[model samples]
Target: QQQVRQSPQSLTVWEGETAILNCSYENSAFDYFPWYQQFPGEGPALLISILSVSDKKEDGRFTIFFNKREKKLSLHIADSQPGDSATYFCAARAYQGGRALIFGTGTTVSVSP
Candidate 1:
């Protein structure tokens, strides 16, 4: 079974609109949550992350809203631009999460002007 899951397999947005991506985890031991963005032909890059202690995290236009009690989280893109089009993934980690990362099915986003 997948420990992490993501909603809306894909997304299409207009420029300037905010894009919201949702994620959930099954393991309560997971204390580290990170979101990654990947462009075509490139590896995923760490966009932002949050610890269980934080309810929210933000970096410029990217934000992560976390709910530890519910074991859920969401990533928000503030300014949807064509350049922002890519695949987004949600991952969780614990002290024993191991060298292999637990990844959710990615959400592919397309932004059009």
Candidate 2:
């Protein structure tokens, strides 16, 4: 089973509209949450992240809202652009050493000009 989950497997938006991506996790031990964006034929890259202690985190056009108690988080992309189109993955990592990040299925976002 996937420890992390994403909603709206796919999404589309106008160039200037905002795109919202949702994520949830199953492990309470997960203390770190990172959102990754991947372009076609490219590896996923970290976009933004938040710790369980934080309620919100933002970077430029991307923001992440976290709810530790509920084990949920959301990524908001402001000013959606066609070049922003890509697959987004929500991931979680525990303090356990020697472990790679666990990722959610993914959310594909398409921005139309």
- Evaluate all candidate structures by whole-model CA lDDT and list the values in order: 0.93, 0.93
**Model 2 stretches astray by more than 4 angstroms:** none
Q: Backbone clashes per model, in order?
A: 0, 0
Give TM per candidate: 0.95, 0.96
Cα-based RMSD of the predictions, in order?
A: 1.2, 0.8
Using TM-score as the measure, the top candidate is 2
- Measured by TM-score, how close is model 2 to the native structure? 0.96
Clashing pairs in 1: none
lDDT of 2 by residue, 9-36 (tens): 9999999999999999988888889999
Per residue, candidate 1 scores C-alpha lDDT tens digits across 1-113 of 99999988999999999999999999988888889999999999999999999999999999999998899999999988899999999998885745557889999999999
Please report, as a residue range, the 10-residue window in candidate 1 with the lowest summed lDDT: 93-102
